[model samples]
Target: MKDSWRRLAERLGGRLAFQAPLRELTSFRVGGPARMLARPEDVGELQELLASARRERLPFIMLGGGSNLLFDDAGFDGLVIKLGAGFAGLEGAGSLVRAGAAAASADLLAWTVARDLGGLEGLAGLPGTVGGAVAGNAGAGPEGLGRAVTRLFVLEGDGRARSIPAADLNFAYRRLEGLPERAVILEAEFALTSRPAVEIRARLAEIRERRGGQPLGGRSAGCVFKNPPSISAGRLIDECGFKGQRVGGARVSEVHANFILAENGATASDILALIDRVRQGVLARRGLALELELKVLGPGGEVRA
Candidate 1:
């Protein structure tokens, strides 16, 4: 199987990411390595790669900027495809902004704001790529990314390209729960409001400052658990007295219980175990089970159980 993939890579003139360490790609700096990492130069290349993987029945993952993800220590054994140059641009005018999937969320938001776009300001400081943001329908306060998304261009699981509308797209709290797992977001067109660039810039700065007030920016996924209706996950964890709890190298952030920090040789397993403890603590004390916002991918190239 490895030889076949290698031959394919050679034919395509694309480099392979063999035993690529997930720790290096993620914000947490944890997780095991992936068996293969493939970066496609264009959408055609991506589709061809997916077709080959499907034909070979090889399991694979579509990796974005690796911000809102937790990978296990076992490492993935399948292919990991990360989009590049072709899917990392920003260009648009009027009330619509066209952004590439691999574009950083911060950069996309900034681009929109520079044009005086108002809708994306709510998501100013969110991490990850535009594709990840769209896939997760990421948001802050009472707004979500989907609210601004008018149309999405996606590479389907069947190696086909199609356009989907916001009405047809399904989204939930921190989850682009409805899009087919096999589909890859290529670019997204957001319908936003025009405002003064200065005002938009100020709003962006304000939100950045707000996120700065939280326990973010460490080697950790942005927010570990999603807030339940009418309750914040961080508050619940803090109320449970689980803040600053440590297990091995993983520590629940004292500043924000929802954030689990890794220090001094923290492993993916440590973070996973700490997550379990936090969830258990919250459930035991508040009788409320919290859901994780970060997608936990296991080693051996499988989604976390």
Candidate 2:
């Protein structure tokens, strides 16, 4: 497998690293290493790499900005493809804006706000990449990223690129459903309303202030669990007295109960254990089962709770 990856690296001629550390890549800051990490320069290279991986029968996973993910302590034994800077372009034509998959959410927000785009003001302080936001349907309150997405350009599992319109998509809470298995989002077009830049900035400021209560600079994923129905997960966890609860080096944030922070010397196991304890406590006390918002990646590239 190492030789196969080496050959693939030579053929692609992009940034490919063996035994790349996964800990530094994620916001959680608690993960092992990846067997192989590849950053493709462009869409053509990405397509070729994916096709080659498939043909070689190698397991592969796509990583965005790594804001909402938790990789296992044992690490991934497969290919980890992260889109390069070439896939981070952003452009605008009137009220419609197009952003590459790897473009940072902060950058996209800034671009739209500068152009007086009103719709994305709700996503002001969101982390991760555009592709991750679109895939997870990231949002602030009732407004989701999918609401602004008009069309998406994706590289399918079969190596075919397709343009999918919003009408054909199924945008649910905290997730974008009905995408083809292994489909990779290349770029997305968002339709936004025209507004004064000052007004947009004001809205953004308001959101930032509201988000000030969260542990912004902490070593943690944004949220640990999704709100159930009309209830807030943080409120429930707080009521359950899980705040400041510690499991090894992972502790529930004192500022926000929904976030589990990783302190120095934290491991993936510590975080996972804390998450389980909090979930059980919430369920036992509140009688409501909270769903996880954090994506836990196992050693085999499978998604865990």
| Index of the highest-TM-score prediction | 2
For model 1, residues 1-68, the per-residue Cα lDDT tens digits are: 56767777786664566787778888888878887788887877787788878888878888888888
- Give the alpha carbon lDDT tens digit for every residue of 1-305 in model 2: 55666776888665888788988889988888998888998888888778877987778888998999999999898888899999999999999999999999999998888878889876788889999999999988755889889999999988899999999998898889868889999999999999988888888889889899999988999889998987889989999999999989999999999999999889999999998999888889878888899998899888975
TM-score of 2: 0.97
- Pairs that clash in candidate 1: 75-299, 75-300, 76-301, 77-300, 77-301
State the displacement of the C-alpha of residue 254, model 2, in Å, after optimal TM-score superposition: 0.7
Index of the highest-lDDT prediction: 2
Off by over 4 Å in 1: 12-14, 300-302
TM-score of each: 0.95, 0.97
- Show the colliding residue pairs in model 2: none
Cand. 2 Cα-lDDT? 0.89
Q: Lowest summed lDDT over 10 consecutive residues: which window, candidate 2?
A: 1-10
